[model samples]
Target chain A: MTDLKLALQEQAEDVDKVLDDLLLEPEGPEAQVVKAMRYSALGGGKRVRPFLVMASSRLFGVSEASALRVAAALEMVHCYSLIHDDLPAMDDDDLRRGRPTCHIEYDEATAILAGDALLTLAFEVLADEETHPSPSVRCALVSELAKASGMNGMVGGQMIDLMAETRELGIPEITRLQRLKTGALIVFACKAGAILGKAKDIKMQALRNYGHDLGLAFQIADDLLDVEASEEETGKKVGKDAERGKATFVSLLGVERAREQAHMLSEQACRHLDVFDRDTELLRAMAQYVVNRRS
Target chain B: MTDLKLALQEQAEDVDKVLDDLLLEPEGPEAQVVKAMRYSALGGGKRVRPFLVMASSRLFGVSEASALRVAAALEMVHCYSLIHDDLPAMDDDDLRRGRPTCHIEYDEATAILAGDALLTLAFEVLADEETHPSPSVRCALVSELAKASGMNGMVGGQMIDLMAETRELGIPEITRLQRLKTGALIVFACKAGAILGKAKDIKMQALRNYGHDLGLAFQIADDLLDVEASEEETGKKVGKDAERGKATFVSLLGVERAREQAHMLSEQACRHLDVFDRDTELLRAMAQYVVNRRS
Candidate 1:
C-alpha cells in the first residue's frame, strides 16, 4: 500500500479506539440506543473528517490527545447524520458501510434516539475539559461545531436537499447545497485545530481555504463514485442520486468534466497549504487521494 | 388571573419574543426548516423550563439578558424534544398546544430537520459569549445541558419510554424513566442559574433537589391530565398513554393516590427552596401551580 493509504488506515484505527472509549455502553434499557450508536459509528468509513482534524492540527503542533478528542466528536456528529439520513423517511437505505443501516439494524425509534444521543454526545465531548484545558477553546469548539452542523450548515443543507429532490437545481444551487450539507462539517474539522492551537488569523484563513476546496473536491469525487462504483467497493447503495432524480455534480458537469474539476480543485487545495512553512504532505496527499481513489 | 397563572402567562410571552428573535427565517430554500423551527418553538407552551431558568437566576442577581439567553436555550431544547416526541415513530401526536404539531405543519423530513436544527441551535446559544461573559460558565451550561439531554438523560429516558410500550413497568422503573426523560432537563434548567452565578455547591445542590421534586410533580400532574383532562383544555390529544397501553403514574396509581402524590411532591419541592433566605414566592407558587393547573 502507498504511504497515504497506510496513514489513513492507521488514523482510522486510532480514531476507532477513541470512539470506543467515548461511547461506552451503560447498564440500562437505554443501552439499546447506545448499542445502535456503536454499531453505526464504529467499524466503518475512511475517517476522512478525522484525518482533516489531525492533519490540520499537526501544523500548529497541537497535542495528540486534544486533536483526537475533537476528531472523535466530529466523527460522532458525522455518523449521527448518516444514521438520520438513512431513515425510511429520508434516503431509506437498508445498507450503510456494508452493514444494515441503524434503522434497519435496530428499530426506527431506537435509530432516531441513537442519532439524537450521538449528536448530543458530540457537544458534551467538546464542552468537557479533556478536549481543551482552556474554557474559551472548549467553548469555541462547541460553538463552531454547532454552527457547522446546525441550521445554516448541515441541517439547512439537508432542507435544501429535500427540496432539490422535487425540483431541478442549477450549478449555483447545487454548489450551495453541497457546501452546507457536507462541506461545512469538513471545514470545521479542519479549523478545529486552529481554535485549539490559537493559530494566527492568516494561517487559520489558509486552512479554511484549503478545507473549502478539499470539501468540494471530495464531494465531486463522491458524486463520481456514486455513478461508477458498485456497493461492494463503496459499502453503500450507489446511483440512488440519479434514481431519486436529485441533482449532483456528476449529473450537472458530466463525469469527464467533473473528474477534471475535482483534480484541479485538489491541486488548488494543496497550494493553499503553502501559507504554512511546515510540512503538509499528509493533507496534500489526502486531497489527491480523495479525487483519485476508487471508493 | 391568579398570581401564579399571571406569572406563567407573562413569562410565556417574554420567551415567545426571545424565540421569535432567535429563530429569524433566513432567505434560502433552507428557510423551510427555520420556519418549521419557528412554528414549533415559538407562540406555544407554558415555557415552564424557561420559567425555572429565570426564577432560579433571580436569586443570584444574574442579569436578565444573560438569564434570558440561557432560558431561551433551555426552551429551545424543550421545544425540540416536543417536536421529535410527536413524530410518527414516537408519540405520533397530531396536535400540540392546541395547534398542529410540527410534522403536521410541515412534511416529516422538514420536521426532523427542524427538530435537529433547534437542538443544535440550543447548544450554539449556550456556547456563545452573549450567554455569559465567562467561558467557564458557557462551557458549564453546554456540558450540563448535553448531559441532561443526551444518552443518560432525556434520550435515554425516551428509549425506556419506547420500551414501556411493549412491557409493563412498576413504579421504580417508571420513576427512573421519568427522571431521565423530562426530569433531567428540568434539573439542568434550575441549576443553570447556579452555574451562571457560580453559586456555592450547597446552594446548587438545593436547587437540584428542588428541581428533582418539581419535575416529578409536574410529570405526575401531566399523567393525571392525560387520564382526566380533555383535548380542548390540555391542547393535546388526551388519554394517549392509556391508548398505547403504556404505564404511567396515573395508570399505576389510582387518581386519588396520584393526586396526593403530586401534591406531596409539590410541597417537598417548595421546602427545598428554603436554602435561600430571600424572597422565593414565585418558585414556591410554581411548585403548587404545576400540581394544580388544569391545563
Candidate 2:
C-alpha cells in the first residue's frame, strides 16, 4: 500500500472505533435491540463509507474529529442496510462479513428492529449539536442523506435489483440499478461531509460527482470480486449472484468487459477529483482502491 | 360514528391526500422504490399517528397546516414500523390495516427498502423548510423522532416481543414491551407537535404522559380485539397471537380482566390531560377513542 493508503487504513480503524462508541445505546427497555444494532454495526467491515466522509472532509481542511459523527452516521446507515438485506425476506443470506448475519445471530424480529434502530440513529447522530453546528448546514445534510437513502436512492436501486433477478438486464439497466442501490449513499456520504466541512457549493458539487463516479466504480468492482474472490478474501459467499441468476456486470458483460468497464469508471471518478486541490490525494487513492482491492 | 369521529375521519382523509401529494418521487432511477414506498405509505390505513400529532398541536393552539409536515412524519415512522414488522422474517403477517402487507404486496426486498426509505423520510420531512421555521425546532423534532423510533423505543420493544414469543411474560414485562414498542412513538408524536407548537417543557411532559397512557390503553384494546373482534372488523386475522403462542394481556389476564385494564389505562391517560385546559377535549376524547375503537 502507498503511504496515503496506509494512513487511510489507520484512520479507518479510528473511524470504526468512533462509530462503535457512537452506536452504544443506554440501558433501557430496548436494550436488546440496541445490542443487536451495536453487534451488526460494530462487526468488522471495510469502513469505506466513513473513509470517504473523512477523506472528503479533509479536502476542505476540516479536522477528522469534526467529521467523525457524520462518518459514524454514514456507517450506521450502511450497516442497517446490510442487516436488512441479509434478512430471510430480502437477499436471504445467512452470513455477512464472515459471520452469521444479524437475523441468524439474533432472531429475525430483532434483526429487523436492529436495522430500524440503526437507520434512525444515523439521523440522530447527524442532528447532534457537535456534528451539526449551523442549522442550515445540518438541514442540508439531512436532506441529502434522506434523498440518497430513501426510495429514490439506495432503496430504489435495491427494488430494481429484486425485479432484475428474473429478467435479462442490459448494461444501461444494470448501471442504473447500481447507481441508485449502491451509488446514492456513497455519494451522500461524501456530500454530507462536504456540507459539514463547509466546502464551497461548487466544490461540494465536484465532490458529489466524485462520489457518484466512485460509487459506481465500487459497485462494478464488487461484481468483479463476486466472481474472483474467495470466501476468505471477500468475507462473503462468492459467485452466489450467478448461482442465484442475479443480474450482475460479469454475468451480463463478459469478465473481460466488466474489468474494462470498472477501469473506465475508476478513471472517470479520479477525473472528478481534478476539480479539487492537491490535498485530495486521498480521494484519488480511493478511486484506484475501488478497482484494485482484492475484496 | 359520532359527529366528532366523522369530522376527524374527514380531516384524516384530507391529510391522506396531502400524504399522497407529498410522497410523489422526483423523477430518477429511484422512482420505483419511491413508488413502492408510496404504495405502502399511502396504502389506505387509519392515520392515527398523524392524528395524534395534529390533535396535540391543536391542543396548543397551532393550526393544522403548521403541524402538517409533523403529522406526515409521524405517519411515515408508523408506516415504516408496520412495513418492517410485516416482513416474513419478522411478524410474518400477510396483512395490515385490511390490505396486503408490504412484503406480500411488493416482494420482500421492495418492502424492506420501502420501510427503510420511509423511516429516513420522516427526518427529511422535519428538516424541510416547508415544515417548520426554526432549525432548532427541526433538530429537536428529528432527535425526538429518532429516540422514539430506535432501540430503547419501538424497535427495542419488537426485539422483546420476538424473544418472548414462546417464553412466558408477566404483566410488567408485557407492559414494558408495549410501552417501548407502541407507547414511545405515540408519546413522541404528541410531544413533537407540542414542541413545534412551542408548548412549555412541563406541558410537553404532561402531554407525553397523556400519550403514554393512551398508547398503553390502545395496546390493551388491541389485545382485546385480537380476541373479540371479527377478522373483517379488525382487518387482521383473529387469534394470531394465540396461534403463535404469543403472550398477550388477554392471554395472561383473561378477556374481561384485559378490558378492565384498558379502561383503567384510558382513564389514567385522561387524568394526565387535566393540565391542558379547555382545548384538551380532543386529546381527552382521543384517549377514550383508543379503548373504544373496534379496530
**Deviation of model 2 at B2, angstroms:** 2.0
Among all candidates shown, the one with the greatest lDDT: 1
Candidate 1: which pairs clash? none
B1-295: candidate 1 lDDT, tens digit per residue: 8887787888888878878888989898899999999998884788889999999999999998899999999998888889889999988889999999998988888888888999999999999998899999999999999999999999999999998888879999999999999999999988988999999999999999999999999999999999999999999999988888888999888899999999999999999998899968999999989999889
Candidate 1: residue B96 Cα off by (Å): 0.8
Best by TM-score: 1
TM-score of each: 0.99, 0.94
How does candidate 2 score on lDDT? 0.82
Each candidate's interface RMSD:
0.6, 2.1
lDDT of 2 by residue, A1-295 (tens): 6866686678778877887777676664456777788788888888888888888877777766768788888888899989988887778898789998998888877888888888888888777777756877777777788888877787777777777766778888888888888899999877866788787888888888888888888988999899999999988888989898887888888889988988898889888777765787777888888899997
Model 1 accuracy (lDDT, Cα):
0.92
Instruction: For residues B1-295, write the lDDT of model 2, one tens digit per residue.
Output: 7755875787678677777877887564446667777887777676777778887877777767758788888888898888888887778899787888877777777777888888888888888888888888888888888888877688888877877875788899999999889999989877866888788878888888888888888999999888889989988778899889988999999988889989998899889887866777777778778888888
Docking class of 1: high
Off by over 4 Å in 1: none
